[model samples]
Structures are given as structure tokens and as C-alpha cells.
Target: MSLIDQVLARAAADPGVRGVILTGSRARGTQTARSDFDVTVVVAEQARPWRHSTRTGTLDEVVCTVEALADTSVHWRRYSFRGAKVLLDRLSGGIAELVDRQATLTAEEAVPLARANLDAYINQLYRCVKSRRDGLADAALLDEQESLPWLLETVFALHGRLRPYNKYLRWELENFPLPDPWSVVLMPDQVRLAPLCLFPAVESLARRRGHADVLDGWGSDIELIRAFAGAAGP
Candidate 1:
């Protein structure tokens, strides 16, 4: 039997273990030669914290109680738990449900988040444009870099999804392309060349999604930024 099978068999024999979940690169099928098995072992709320590992460090085990698992913050664990796989669930599917909850974002949660990220992203883009107008190339580049994460967060929240980790961003986009015009500009290569390529699409999406107020908050400044960015094509 493989090491994973042996580990699962042992976990099955432990009465305290409520479930076993496979996570990290191995679970996402993005592992490299150096990747290890990332496992989460769930137990009763009263159970003491513990861990398990192999001598060669091929396995990384984390032990948590049901209460702790449920209490985990979505912001902190969302990317980590995304695409997780349940190897065993003695809770009759409760564990699987928890994993799903950790991976998802409801519309109610997404809307306000999208607004906030859009505000931040536009703020950075405006700064980038102003710096360029002033001939401050270094400052403009810094502002451009600063805006990327916010831009990504805004896009993901618009779709009620989590912003993936940078390492997985390309993989996620390739597997699940965004809607229409947004998809083309977000490709890794395109983004590397010029992230501003998505500005027009993002602006349209934000306006259609009831974020016109946020954009309007910037007034004519945004129009100038848009014009300047367009003129400065990738």
C-alpha cells in the first residue's frame, strides 16, 4: 500500500479522528517533485491539539477540533482550503460541507468587498497615472505594482469567488476563465506585459454591478486616468 493509504488506514482506526482532508498543492494537482502531502485531521472539540509527520517530512499533518475548524476565518483560510479533498468524513458529510463553506463567498459578502477593492485599485491606478504625467517613472511603476492585488481581489469578488494566491492565480484563471473581456486581459502573460489592459473591462463590470457610485466618487480624475492609460498602451 502507498504511504497515503497506510496513513488513512491508521486514521480510520482512531476513534477520536472525525475526518481527514487532503489539501495544498497535492490536493490541487499542482504539486512539484518537492511537494509533500498536506493533511488535516479533525477531531472532537474537546480533543487536545496534536500532529503527525513522516521521518522524511513527506507528510505534513495538522490536527484540529470541529469547533476550531468551524471558527477558522475565511480571510485567513480561504485559499488554503480551496479545492480541498475529503479522504474520510466520520461526520456523515459535515466536514465536506465545512470545506465547501470555506471555499465559497456569498453575494452578500462579495458585493461590499468588491466595492472596497475597486476603490483601492482605482486609487492606485490614478496615482500611477499622475506619476507618469509628472515623469516619475519609478513612482508610477511602484503604484502599478501596488494596484495589482487590489485589482485581482476586485475581479474575484465581483464573481463571488476568493482571490487565489499569486502562485495559483494563473492556474485558476486557466482552469476557470473570467467572463468575456475580463478573461483575455487577466492571462498571466498579458498581465505581466501590462496589467492596465483590464482597466476598461473592470470599469464596465464595476459600473454594471452597481459600483458606479464608487467610480463616480473619483469624478473626472478616473476619465483622465483611463485616457492616459489607453494612450500608454501595452
Candidate 2:
């Protein structure tokens, strides 16, 4: 049997291991030649934490209980499992289903998250510009660092999509992009260029969603940034 098959077979026979899931690049069909296998072993609530093992050269194992996996607050873990490949599921199939469900954002969750991220982006953008105006170059750079992620998250949540981890951002964009305008914001590398691309993208999204109120909250600041960014040029 192959190494992966042997590992799954062993996990299936273990009374303590209730389920086995394969995650990371291999599961996503994006693995490079150097990539290793990542596996999560789910145990019962009362069981001891199963030891993480790397006995096989290319396999890395993580152990957690169903309770931990079910906690939506553990977003990173949930995101990790969202695209997981089930190996052995002797736990009534609930683990696999839970992972799949958590991958998606409901309107209820997305709307508030979008608003919060939008507000945060505006706040950071304001600080960035203000710092530059005051000749605090270092402070402006720091604010720029803080602003981009919030801006990206805002756009993703507005579209009822989860913002992927930094490592997967390119993959997510290539596979499942947002509607036009917003899509180009992430393409640029310069901080000045970001606002130039992002402003119209956000405006387009707001107009499309009939969320005029969302843009209204930061309308003036956005315009000010847009003017400055426009003068800065590509």
C-alpha cells in the first residue's frame, strides 16, 4: 500500500481516533514537489490528546477533539479543514460536514464583518494619509501595513466570502474572484497604488449591492484619498 493508504488504515483501526482528515496543499491540489502531507486526527472529547507524529518522512499529523473542531471561534482551524479531504470517518460523518459548512459565509455573518472591516480600513487609511501629510513617513508606512488586510477583508466579506489567509490569497483570487473593480485592488504592490485601485472597486461593490450607506460612512475620506492617489499616479 502507499504511505498515505497505510497511514489512513492505521488511523481507521485506532479506537481513539474517531476521524481522519487530509488538509493543506495536497488536499487543495496545489502541492509543489517539496510539499508534505498534513493530516488532522479527531478524537473523542474525553480521550487523551493523541500524540502528534512524524514517523513517516512526508506526513505531519495534528490531533484535536471534535469539541475543538466544532468551535467556530477557532477560525484558522476551521478554515484549514474547510477544504479537507476525508480519509477515515467513523464518527457518523459529522466532522466532514462541519468542516464543509464552516467554509462558507452566510449573509448574517458577512454583513457585519464587512461593515467592521470597512470601518477599520477607513480608520487606517485616514491615519496613513494624515501621517504622510504631517511628514511622519515611518508612521504612514506602518498605517499602510495595517490598512491593506482590512481593505481586502472588507471586499471579501462584502461579497459573502471569507478572506483567505495570506498564503492562500493569490490562489483564492485566481480560483474565485470578486466582481470587477474590487478585483484589481490586490494586484498592485505599492501602498500609494492600493488606494488608487481600491477606491473605485469598493465604490462599484457598494453600488452593486445597494449598500450606499456603507460607502456613505467614509465617503469624504475616500474621496480625499482618491484625489491624493490619483495625483500620485501609477
Candidate 3:
């Protein structure tokens, strides 16, 4: 049997193993020759040692109980299962269905997340600007680093989309993308230029979504940054 098959057979025979799923690059069909299998085995209540062998390549496994999986606060693990492929599901509680459900966000969830992300982005933008004005190049660079992810998350939340892992960001942008000019500015290398490109788009989205309060004063802030950079204000 193949490595995957053998692994599934072992999982199916375990009474504690409620479900088995394949995740990571292999599950997503983006694996390289050296990519290892990332399997998550969901159990009833307790965790167990991960099974692995060099001969069959790495079988990176995580053991979690159904209760933990059901908890909304346990987001990272659920996010990992978003693109997972189910191998064996014998749990009567519909654990596999729960994994599938976490792939997307509801509008209610997206709105607050988007607002929070925008708040964080604006805070970071201010820090970046202040650091630059004060001639703290290192501080400015650090602020910029902190700002980018917030900006990306804000954009994704505004569009009601899940933010993919960093490795899949380029692919996600190429295939899904945020919206017009916004996506153009969200490139990894264009971090410094993001505020200049992102402000107008964010302002528009905030207004359209009745979130104007969340982005209040953003226009003036953008103008201030642009003026400081010797660029024409929008």
C-alpha cells in the first residue's frame, strides 16, 4: 500500500482515532518531491504520539479532541483543516463537516475582523510615518513590517475572503485578488508604497459598508503622508 493508505489503515483501526485528514501542500496538490505528509488525526479526548518513518517520508500528525475542534476559539487548527482532504471519518459527531465549515467566514464575522484589521493598519501606518519623520529608519522599517499583514488582513476581510498562509499569498492574489487598485499595491515588495495605494480604496470600501467611523480621518492621514513624501495628495 502507499504511504497514505497505510497511514489511513492504521488510523481506521484505532478506537480513539475519530477522524483522519490530510493537510498542507500534499493535500492541496501543490506538493514538491520533498514535501512531507501533514496528517491530522482527531481523537475523542486525549492526544497521542505522532507516527512517522523516514522510509515513507514524514507523517506530521496532530491529535486533537472533538471538543477542541468544535470550539470557535481554536482557530489556527481549524484554519489548517480548511484545505485539508479527509481520508477516514468514523466519528458520529460530524467532525469532518465542522472542518469544512471553517473554510469561509460569515458576513457578521468578516465585518468586525475587517474593522479591527483596519484599526491596526491605521495605527501601524501612523507609527511608520512618525518614525520616518523622526529619522528613525530602523523603527520605520519595523513599523512597515507590522503594517503589511494588517493591511492584507483588512483587505481580505473587507472582501469576505480568508487570508491564505504567507506561502500561498502570491498564488491567492494571482487567482483571487482583493479588488482593483488595492491588489496592485498589496505586493510583498511594495510594502512602503501600500498606504499611498491603499487609502482611497479603503476609504471607499468603508463608506460602502457603512464603516465610515472605523476609517475616520484616514483621508487626511493619507494626505499628510503623501505631502511628507513629496507626492501629490489625492
In each prediction, how many residue pairs overlap at the backbone (N, C-alpha, C within less than 3 A)?
0, 0, 0
Candidate order, lDDT descending: 1, 2, 3
> Which pairs of residues collide in model 2?
none
Q: Can you write out model 2's per-residue Cα lDDT over 22-139, one digit (the tens) per residue?
A: 8888988889988889888888855554457564558898787877666666445556764679887776788787667668777988888888877787778778777877889899
**Which window of 10 residues has the lowest lDDT sum in candidate 1?**
47-56
Model 2: lDDT of residue 39: 88
Off by over 4 Å in 3: 47-57, 91-93, 175-177, 181-196, 217-223, 226-234
* TM accuracy, model 1: 0.89
Candidate 2 contains a number of clashing pairs equal to: 0
> What lDDT does model 1 reach?
0.83
After superposition, the stretches of candidate 1 with alpha carbons farther than 4 Å from their true spots are 46-57
Better of 2 and 3 by TM-score: 2
In angstroms, give how far residue 215 of model 1 lies from its true place: 0.8
**Error of model 2, residue 122, in angstroms:** 0.9
Q: Candidate 1 at residue 163, lDDT?
A: 89
lDDT of model 3 at residue 152?
Answer: 75
Error of 3 at 77 (Å): 3.7
